[model samples]
Structure formats: structure tokens, C-alpha cells
Target chain A: MAALGREKMKQLEAQYKKILADYIVNQTEKNLYIAQNFTRQLIQKNISPEDVISIHKNAIAEIFPDRMNEAQPAYDFLIEVMVHYGMAHREHQSLLQKQAEYEMEMKIATSIQKALLKTHIPKLSTVDIGMLSVPARKMNGDYVHFFYHRDDYLSVAVTDVVGKGVPAALCMSMVKYGLETLEYAYKEPSYVLEVINRVIEKGVDDSMFVSMFYGCLDTQRNMFSYASAGHEPALHYNAKQDQFVALEAKGLLLGVLPNTKYTYQEVILEDNDIITMMTDGVTEFRGNDHLNSRQIITSVIRDNKYLSAQQLCQLLYREIEKIHGFDLSDDFTVVILKK
Target chain B: MASKSSVEIITEWDIVAARQLGRNEAKALGFGTVDQARITTAISELARNIYLYANIGRIEIERVDTETEKKIVVTATDQGPGIHDIRKVMEEGYSTSGGVGAGLPGVKRLMDSLEVQSVIGEGTTIRAEKWLR
Candidate 1:
């Protein structure tokens, strides 16, 4: 009987050794099964949970030498904790990958938006055209387009969408399409707005709208016909009168109502006369003291009426920037047409 | 009187913006994950058509809520050359640009309702809607 008991003890010791060896060698499901069975045997042999935890820590150290310095509690926690940690690490890696992909997409989108705002200005001999557009953010909601329809008619449009960023930029692109397509068929400012309003009403959502100023210069007749769709009034500098007049044409904002009627106002331009059309960013700029910005714009045009169109535009922009300390809160756009 | 939003489609990047915005609007309207994906895909196809055929266009998304159910509406309009044969364009596997030809028809299949109006020399407007069941 003594020999049989000693033999049983020896077999149990051999079985435990084999289980630990198998767990260290492969760490597979079969190894896990063996370890579980060995744990039960240890419990049956009156081994304390503390002793089991120590054994597990030593085995883990053998498998992962780099983790030997890690803090380990004396309690016998579930071995599945290690598997959970592995899975969490993998999930973190995948999340970082997805974040990188999103950043790349945003970068590409920003570049495309920037390209859309870089429009080409047309050159005309009869009138000097000066324009500037600066976005508060990476994407601009302001839009301007010049169409030289046949050599006799020069059409220029300036538009401002209600919002900013990607959505606003997208709305501006629609305005571009509306202007291009309507200009092909109509030259009258009111007719152009009528068609563009219909297009916007059909496609634009109620949450958004656009304010636009469309003007056509008949070079032969020296007549400028313009219409406003709830946009800021254009400033006209009469060289002979030596005064500023606001060209206020009334119409509803585009996309607000269908079949909206817009009336066009015509102006006869004399030599050295100037017409300045700007978005609200200029007229609505709040200085340090909340000074009236519209008055400042008018004064600037009145003071710089003698300068060339390009010089006057730069001067006005500089003055506005100086007032805001070079930090503008909105997108700024100005189109200056001088005869 | 649903909440509405609009985006312009000029380049390929605008198409991505439209898709993303559409998905967000649908989600805001309590659309399911499958419905959001479907709406986004339809926006992608419509925005791409604007860039391909019209050179420029606009897309509008709105959320409609009634006493019975909720719905999301999307409208796409372009002043480019309009479609000649509306019936053929709506048919599956009919493409004028050598593509898979599943654009308009695929959008129709994904949405609950689809309406298309085209003037040969003027432009085309397409409106699509999905209802949350």
C-alpha cells in the first residue's frame, strides 16, 4: 500500500509538469484544457489559491520575460484577463488606423475646397476689374464669377451663402452653376435672378439661402444694369458729383421663395466712375468700439476714389483688416469695377 | 416644414461632402444604420452625376416628420445638358457615359420614392425620399 501511494504522488507530479510544459510550448486550446484540469488537481491536493497565483505569475514570466517587472497581485485572477488585454490592444490599433484615414479624407476635401475659391478674373480694356476674396476658415462660402459674353457684354456676379465650411462651399458651387447657365441665356440682371431663384428653390434646402448681386456692363452703351437678391447694396462713386451713392435694389433672398420678382436698375458710367460690390463681411465688420462699418466702407471709397481700381481695393481691404487687427471673423469678398 | 440643408457639387470632393452630410442628416432624423448607408450611397451617385454631366450642381436634404412617420428627402439639381430619354435613364443597365448605368435606377431602388424632371436644353432635377418604418 505504501508503494502504491508513492507511485500515485509521482504520477500526479508528472501530470502537473506536463500541463505547465504544454501551456508554455503552444498556449493552445488543448493546453488551456490541461491547465484547467491541473488547477482542479491542485485544489484537490489542498494547494492555496495564493500558491496557484504565484505559479501562474512565474509561468507568465517564462513566456513573456519583458513583462516580469509588471505589477501582479497575489490573488488568483482569471487567465482570460490576458486574452482581454490582447483584444483591447488590437482594437486600439484599429481605431488609430481609422483616425488616420479620416484625417487623410479631410485633408483632401480641404484642398478641393480651396481650389474652388481660386477663380480667374477676366481682363477688359474699357473697365478695370479688381477683386479679392479671403476665407475666415479653410473653406470659403463667398463666390464671384465674371463672364464676358460676346465682347459687348460683361457680366459679373458676387454671391454669399448663409453658412461656412464644407456645406457653405457646396452651396456656393451651386450658385456658380446657376450663374454660368443663366448667363448663357440671359443678360438682363432681373431675368438672371429669376432663373437662378427657381434653380435654387428647386435644389436648396430651407435652412440655407444665398444673397447675390448680378451686374452686366454694356461696354458699347456704357450702361451698367444690376439687380440685388437681398444682398448688400453696391456702392457707386460718381467722379463728377464727388459723392457716394448706394445702389439698393430690392429682391428676396435666393432659395427663400419661388417666382420671386427682381427689378434691375441701370446706371450710366462716366470716365473714372467706380462701382464696388462686396459681401456682408465688409459692411458688417464690428470694430473695437462697435463703430458703424458701412460708414467706414463708404468713407474709404470716397477717400480713395482717385486711385486705380486695384489700388482702391487693396487700400479698402487693408483698412478693414487694420480695424479688426488683421483677425477677421467672416469671409471677405469685394469686386471693384471702374470705368 | 422639415429641417433642411444644402450643398453644392462641383468636383469629386463635393460628392463626398454630400454623402457625408446626407448620412448625418439621416442619422439625425433617427434613421436606421442600413437606411443611413443607403441614403449616403444614393447621394454619392447623384452628386457624381452632377460633376460628370452638369459640371456643377446643388443638393438639398430635408427631414420630414408627420404624426404617423418620419421621412428624409434629398433633391439634386443641375443646369447642365438634361437627360434626353428619362425612361431609358431610369432603366437599369442603361448608361450614356459607359459606366455601370446603375446610378439613377440604383438610387430609385434604395429610396422609398423617386421623382425626376428633365428639360432637354435646360436642366434636370431629381428628388428622392426614404421613410423610417
Candidate 2:
């Protein structure tokens, strides 16, 4: 009877040690299964690391009060891992907030740029005008303005700044204001360009400059006088000859010199003559073949000479889009005046 | 040591590209924000001049590190009408075009060193460098 009692006491002691070891190491089959579910619930409830550590301490104290003091290193490792996770979570949350703020700002900027680009082509009996502007990004750097002066002449200007995004858009608004305010100063294209250069030179930054082509069309005499300020050569289509000739003029870009000289050239418009002024974006299209975009432009105008001004502009845009697979590399703007 | 990248300036978009590439190069060379902005602005001015005068050009950015310091060198070249009077073009208020007359001079002020070479009717090339402080 004594031997049997001793064996039973030994068995009970062994079982107690096994339970304490499992609680310390957290490595028994039953303990591991329970812990997996418990940890998932803890994470789902968003329990902080501090609360989790305290809960673990209390559980260990309740089961094996004497062994709780021995699990210090294991507890420290768990705390370290939890702290790292918390930091990463906070960083992710802040990143998300920053992204949302950036998106909102971009949305507002896009709307403002859209509002500035809103322009309508004037209706006239002597000539038909068509214009289109497309931004490569959310904002554009190309600008076009038209003024119907005193029912005798129509003035049109196309300008492209050497930057993009918000700065370029802001500069475009300044160009618009300069054009509007200086329309009454002179009816000559060269004089108008000089005035605009002075205004922009005073207002704009040194790094920014504008390339522009401004032209005035006399309704009664069918005469066109235009000036170029480092802009792309405007194409003049001779209807009688069925040939496209570039109206090349020499001048410096605007906002570069305070008092620069701009020279103007005169052309007599004939029946069914078409004049197209465009930014470099139209001619510099790069695609599968770097298609001679200028050639395509001239040919399109030649083929569609019978169409109305609006239709011709649409056809030209569509042809260019086809060549580029609808992926424009830069901002595109074109103004067409047909008589 | 030298690490180099080149951007083609054919239009306004190319000007932006040149600026971005320059800024990236400056950043890679451990330049601070102000230095990077200065490098980019200088690149913009040079590239814009090329586009305005030459119609097409290339901007090359290089990172150079010597035993003592690191530096970024930017070179803009064009095969268009070369400068007739280099001194006049570099003057702050003298411009052939109706510009603010700040292209070359502003670039000179923003950079540590500037070298301009041109031959009439051949082309123009401008090299500007900024040393990391």
C-alpha cells in the first residue's frame, strides 16, 4: 500500500510539471490550437499590445503563479514584435491619409485648369474659325485667344509656354489677360506682340518663356498680317495652286527681352484659302514610325479642303489620333481660319 | 567617376523632361533640395534656349565625384543657329528675343561654373556645373 501511494504521488507531480512547462513555452498541441484562435480574436478586436501583454500575464499568474516570474525573456520578445507591428500600422494609416489629400488637391487643380480653357469660337460671315486644345496631362501649357475687334478685323493668338502643370496653367492665364488688355492698343500683329512681351516680361519668372504666333485678318480686304515669336511656322494653303507653304517669320520668344522687335508679314487671302496655326505638339508626334506629322497634317487639310472649318479640325485631330494610337505625348492645340 | 543621362528637347514637353532628368541626377548625387532646384531651373533655362533658337536639342546630365567633393554637370547642345554675340546674350538685360533677358545670366548665377561655346550657323553648346556643399 505504501508503494502504490508513492507511485500515485509521483504521477501527479509529473503531470503538474508538464502543465507548467506548456504554459511557459506555449508549445503543447492543445495550447497551440487554443492560442491560434485566441490571437485571431485579439487581432480582430484590435486589442493593443499592452492589453494583450497584461492579459497574458494574468492568465499565466492564474494557472502557474510561481512560474510567471521565469517567463520574462519570452514576454520581452513578444512585446518587441507587437511594438513593431503597431508602428507599421500607424505608418500605413498616415500614408493613406497623405494619398487622399494629394488626390483632392489634384482634383481641384484639374477643375481650375478646365475653367480657364473654356473658350468659344466666334461666328462670322466672312471667315470660319475652328480651334481645339487637348492637354497631355491633367493641365495644359498651350493657350489660344481670339478677339473680334470693331467688326473690321479678327485677331487670333496661339501661345505655348515651356513648362507644364500648375505653373504653366497659371502662366497661360496671365497670357490671356495680357492679350485681352492689349487688344485695344493696336491692330497690328507686331505691335501687339511687343506689348504682350513687355507685360509678360514684367510678370513672369525668368525660367518661363512663351512662343506665340499672332495674326490679324481684315474682313473687307481679305488681308492677313501675322507675327511669329519663336513659334512654329504657320501653314498657309494656296487654294489656286493646291500647295501648302509655311509662313516663316523671324523673332525671339516672348518674356525674354523687355523691348524686342517683332516683324510682321502680309498675305492676300484668296477664295477657299485655309490657314492653320498649331503648337509643336501637333508636328512632333512620336509613334511606331515617328510619322511625318506635318506632312500628314498638310495632306489631311488638302484632302478635306471641301469640308467646313469645324469638320476639317475634327478630321485633322482624328487623323493625328489614329497615328498616335490615341496616346498623345504632349499638349496639342490647333487653330484654323478658313476664308 | 562619371554617371550620365541624356534627354532630347524637341518641344515644351522635352523641356520638362530635361528638368526632371536633371533633378533626378542631382538627387542621385546626394544634392540637397535647394541644390536640386537650382540645377533643375538652370537646366530649364538652357533647354528652353535651345528650343527657342535651335528648335531641337539634347541635354546631358552627369554626376562627377572627385576625392574631395561630388558635383553635377549639365550640358545643353543644339544644331541650330549659333549665338552671334556670346557676351551680349549672356548680359542680364540683353536678349535677341523678347524675353526677360535672364536665360544665360540666370543660369550662370544658379550654377557654380558655366562655359559657353558657339559658332555662327553651326550650333551652340552650354555647360553648367554645381558642386555639392
Global lDDT for candidate 1? 0.78
lDDT of 2 by residue, B48-115 (tens): 88777788889999999878878999999888888778887775444334432235755775678898
* A44-106: candidate 1 lDDT, tens digit per residue: 564433334445555565556786665343212332233223223333444567789978987
Candidate 1: lDDT of B63?
85
| Cα lDDT for residue A158, candidate 1 | 88
Interface RMSD of each: 19.8, 20.8
Report the lDDT of model 2 for residue A138: 86
The TM-score of predicted model 1 comes to 0.54
